[model samples]
Target: MSTARQNPLSYDEAVTWIQQFSKSSIPRDQVTASFSRSSGPGGQNVNKVNSKVSLRLQLDRATWIPPHALQKLKTSPLVNKAGELQTTSDRTRSQGKNLQDCYDKLIQAIKQAVTVNRPADLEALAKIEKR
Candidate 1:
C-alpha cells in the first residue's frame, strides 16, 4: 500500500512513512534472501547448516518505500554497488530466526536513514517563553 509521497519529506512525514512500512508493508517479492553457513559457534550445526541470512532489496525495485525515504536509503552503507540494500544475520543458528533478524536490521537501517529530527518551531517556543 504505497502512497504518493512528497519529493522532499518533512520530518513528520518521514516518521509516518517509517511507521507505515515498519509493519509488513515491504513487499516480499521485492526482497531476495540468500543463505550461507554461519561461522559462529553452534556445535556441528554451525558448520553444516546454512543458518546465515543475507537479505537484499534493490532500491529501484522497492517502490513500496516512500520516494524521499528511498532516496535517503540509497545513501545507506548497506546499499551495494548493484544498488541493493543488504542485511545479513548469523546471530542465531536458526535460518528462520536469522531471516527475521535480517528484516529487523533492514527496518532499523531504513528508520535511521529516513528519520530526520526537525528543530523546535520558533513561533511555538515564543508562545511559551517566559519574561
Candidate 2:
C-alpha cells in the first residue's frame, strides 16, 4: 500500500484530484470560470480593477457524481449555476485576497462534495421523518 498522503489542492495534485473528485461521467469541459472587477473600497483603483473571481462547475455533465452528493450541492444555498458555486472577497482591496477567496471556496466545495453519510444515521432520519 502506498504511504503517501493525498494533498488534493497541491499545485502538482490538481489534475489527479479533479479526476478522482469529480464525477467520472462528466466531461472536463463542463467546468469554466470568469473574472470581473470587484466592488467596494480601494478608491479609484477599485473602480477600474477586476479583482473578483467566478468559477462555474457544470453538473449536468457530471455523470459520475452520486445522487446524495448532487442533492447536497443542489440544496446548498451557496451553490449557483444550477450547480456552480461561487465565492468572492474584497476585504483587503487587493487582488491577492480575492484570488485566495476563490481558492478557499473551491476547497470548501470539494470538502462538501466528498462528505459521506452513515447508513444508520440516515435510517434514523427516515424514521423520524415518518413520525
Candidate 3:
C-alpha cells in the first residue's frame, strides 16, 4: 500500500516495509548514520559543514523483517557484499533533508525489489508490442 508519508519517515522502519511487506518498527540502535561534508557546489557552505548523510543498515543484525523478505532484500542492489544497506544523499544543503532523501531512496528501492507485474499487466504490454 502506498501511503503519503510525512517528512522524516522512520529510517529503519522504512527498510522493514520495503522487504517485509509490513511497516513494523526496527530498532534504532541497529542503524548507523554518519554525516560528512557534501561535495559539489554551495561554495563556503559546502566547505564548512557536514551536510551529507550516510545511512547504513546492518543486515546481519536486522531481525525485524520476515525471513523471506530478508532473503529477497539481500538479492537487491541496495545490499552490498558486507550485507549492509547503504545510501547517501546531498540533494539538499540541510543535513536533515539529505538524511530523509537517503531514507526515501532506500524505501523506493525496496518497493521496486518487491514489485511484481500481474498477468493483466503482461497482457497490456504484449498488446502494445503488437502495435
lDDT (0 to 1) per candidate? 0.84, 0.59, 0.70
Q: Per-residue lDDT for 129 in model 2?
A: 95
- In candidate 2 the C-alpha lDDT for residue 46 amounts to 75
Q: What's model 3's lDDT at 34? A: 94
TM-score for candidate 2: 0.55
Question: After superposition on all CA atoms, how large is the RMSD of candidate 3?
Answer: 9.5
The collision pairs in model 3 are: none
Model 3 misplaced stretches (Cα beyond 4 Å): 1-24, 116-131
lDDT of 3: 0.70
**Which candidate's lDDT is highest?**
1
Native-to-model Cα distance after best TM-score fit, residue 22 in candidate 3, in Å: 8.4
Q: Which segments of model 1 are wrong by more than 4 Å? A: 1-6, 123-131
lDDT of 1 by residue, 32-71 (tens): 9999999976999987899999999888987666677788
Candidate 3, residue 76: how far the Cα is off, in Å? 2.6
Better of 1 and 2 by TM-score: 1
Candidate 2, residues 1-131: lDDT per residue as tens digits?
A: 12242212343344454456533433548656566776777788877887666656666555445444555666667677566655556665667667666666765665566455333668789999999
- Decide which is better by lDDT, 1 or 2: 1
Error of 3 at 66 (Å): 2.8
Q: Tens digit of lDDT per residue, candidate 3, span 19-129?
A: 565323546787778999989557899999999999888877866554445567788787878898888898878998888888777666556544443335687899999
| Candidate 2 Cα RMSD (Å) | 10.6
